[model samples]
Target: MEQIVQAECCGKTITISTGKIAKQASGAVMIKSGDTMVLVTAVAMKTAKEGQGFFPLTVNYQEKAYAGGRIPGSFFKREGRPSDNETLTCRLIDRPIRPLFPEGFLNDTQVMATVVSADKDNDPAILSMIGASAALMVSDCPFAGPIAGVKVGRVDGKFVANPTAEELEKSDLEIVIAASQEAILMVEGSAAEVSEDDLLEAIFFGHAAVQPILAAQLELAKKVGNPKRDIPAPVVNEALKARVAALAKEGMKQAVRIKTKVERHLAIDAIRDEAIAALVPEFEGSEKEVKGFIEDLEYDLVREHIIKDGERIDGRDTKTIRAIATEVGLLPRAHGSALFTRGETQSIVAATLGTSVDEQRIDSLYGDSRKKFMLHYNFPPYSVGETSFRLAPGRREIGHGMLAERALQQVLPKHDDFPYTIRIVSDITESNGSSSMATVCGGALSMMDAGIPIKAPVAGIAMGLIKEGDDFAILSDILGDEDHLGDMDFKVAGTAEGVTALQMDIKIGGVTREIMAAALAQAKDGRIHILGEMAKSIAAPRADLSAFAPRITTI
Candidate 1:
């Protein structure tokens, strides 16, 4: 049986049809808005790879240049590798659905989301997530889904569900959230610094509004879902687990007792190296696997101790932030510069105010677009205490930069309020964790240093979660290792009164509301603490732009 469902989203009619396209795929769907359409397909490999512990699911989101009646910009005039935007969109599609799959089903799976057509006013990221979920539900992939996503915006403190591109121009919040029928799976966006309560309200509203879409997917799945394939559960050797656990126990205990970020990391690395060497004699055939398992176990133990025992790796309480230092006008020649360091993560954010002529004009499938504010994030090799090639910003850097950009967009002065085209560059000098949030803090201070007179000061904090069965701990201002080992990364940005932006990603099955509430509460405490540190250096934006920066006059 084939089915098609239609509804109004962001003032446009959105239609979804399954069993009509890519019929051979386990599950497939076509989503359309006006003439712009997207075909999403999902397929899982017949067999799981032996000894492959990680889920081998891959998501590819492609934007055809021809979709918008344009040729590729490159000299080849053909699409090649995925652009940064496309890669991030693929990641967005991957994050929400990946967790919804059943654990232990490690079959090779692929989800392809292609924008066959695109309307200039509608963004394809949220729709792609929707299509991906629809396809998985209808496929034999064993997805615990019927998940749906929406882009929420804020204008004059009112929340708008699935706002169009034009509406986003006037909105302070550009939030994308993916949710199952019961809980949110993924959230990423930028906000102006909205209150904590408002942020939670927006999440609830988005969840409620997307429920109908989830219902539609479930209905389609019932009609066309394929018979799920059987895959063996991932096996863990009992002996290997026990041996490695013993090796890491004491070292992990010492690592967690340290007080500073750098010191703790050094101790952990030494412990891991020693454990790997000691385990080589016990497991000759699977030495590599044994070491990897040990490291993961060490992380798990650290997180459990933090949550259950009320202890952190860096010895901070659950609500405590790392030490913070702020300095303005750090660079003599820069228009406006500020260096903000929270624990070991440091960002030197510089602001360059320009006239309307300096605004960036971007040509894309959506057509010509002008952006008045641009935020660029750079991560050099030395930032992480490593040495590597000096190339262009990779997808991670670009994605992180964009996240920070969105976080700060909520508080930027409007064209009517201040006519300058603002560009902020965050140079990460050191990174242990959450450089993007540091970019937000530093960008705010830099704009103030440059005298942009922004509406309000914005701050951001990264929250981490460690879950063991029913026991869970929410850590505010988590370190890099905690992020890697934790189950969830929840970032919130906002003003003292409300939230401006929120983004959440989970590694395991979607988190319950109880965990989300805890994360939000912890984030607020960390955000306020960070804002207090920022206030000590500068309380508000300056009254005049830097002489070096271009001046713009509004009519």
Candidate 2:
């Protein structure tokens, strides 16, 4: 039987339909808004792969050429690998739903969203996100979702929910917000240095606007949704857990206090190994559980230290930022260069200038458009003291680069004012956490070093969250370890005047508006502090372009 539901959102109607196609899959839904349509399907393995320690969830968003009434541009006359936009859309869909699955359910799951039709006025990405959520909700995938995605833009002064493409071009703020019925789950967007309060308002506005869509999804699910699969509780050996805790408790307490990341990790690993060795003989066939308990102990200890003592792994207070060091014009031969180091994270950014011919030509469903500025982020293995294949830049690098690019794009001179094609390359020389934020700071300085007349200098910082029941703590300028162990990784970038870009992802179900507001306020302070430190190296754009830079003549 076909099940359909529709709701009015932002002056437009969104329709979701299921049970008409892809019926063999665990769940499938087709969502439409305006002329744009996206079909999303969810599937999961009946059982998890043996001994799989981590959940393997894949999300793929593909755009078919036929959907846009166009032929493939490639020589083969067919669609190729995932495009940058597709990869980013995949990420956006994945972020909110990844944390919704039960912890013990490690079954291999996949969510695929394919654009079946595209309209020039409406964006299919938002529809895809909504479809993914609806599909998961109807599936027997054990997913805790019924979330919705909305794109909020400010036209003139009012917040416009689900703005059209033409409206977005004129809007000063463009943010995509995904939320559940109660709280916002994911937010990623760029703005024109919009103030903090205005940004917060836009977020809640978007969140409120999606409530109708969420209602429609629930209605549809109630009619046709499959019974969710049962997830077995993790088997716990109380005796073994108690024994391992007793053996490693003291060592873990001492290990977590060490300031150096490498040293602390080594100490903890030593304790874990020692506990496993001593207990494995007695608790045979329980090595995995023993290791799990030790890890849990460490996780608990770290959170306790942070919440009760208000201290982080680096001994910084919740609101304090790490030491910052910056240098510009360090590479004499490059067009422009800057090295930005914050705590253990570092980025070496170089800027290059070119003519109109160098501008990137991007072809997409919305048609071809030329980008006057480009940013590429590279993360080599040696940056983290590791060794791996030097393949092409992966999706994470691309995503980070685009984020930093968005952070700086708002401040760049208009194409009419500065017609030269600009490209900034950020190479992460070292990383602990917030490397993307470091890229943002370094990219700004490098552009200034190249004599680009930017509107203002931009800086970025990453904030973390640790929530346990009624208590929660937000950490500013979080380290890599904190990002892994904490519940949220929220990054904000902007000029001292306001915010330019924001990206947030969380492991928990979601956070309240109050928490989001607090995080943004803390991020603003950290961003300002980082900016002040950055100004010490180079206060503004240079008086002239680099001597080696090519001079462009506007026709």
Residue 233 deviation, candidate 2, in Å?
1.0
After superposing candidate 2 on the true structure, give the runs of residues whose Cα lies further than 4 Å from its correct spot: none
Quantify all predictions' global Cα lDDT against the true fold.
0.82, 0.92
lDDT tens per residue, model 2, 1-555: 999999899899999999999999999999998889999999999988999999999999999988999887888988899988999999999999898999899989999999989997777989989999999989888989799999999999999998887899899999999999999999999999999899999999999999999999889989984788888898889999899988999989989888887788889889988998999999888889988998899899999999999999888999998889999998998899999998889999999999978988887876788988899999999888889976588889989988999999999998888889999999999999999999999999999999999999999999999999989999999999899889999999999999999999999999998899999999999998899999999989998999999987778
TM-score for all models, in order of appearance? 0.90, 0.99
State each candidate's clash count.
Answer: 16, 0
Cα error, candidate 2, residue 291 (Å): 2.0
Residue range 66-158, candidate 1, lDDT tens digits: 889888877798888886689889888988888777778878899999898887666787789899998888788888888888888877778
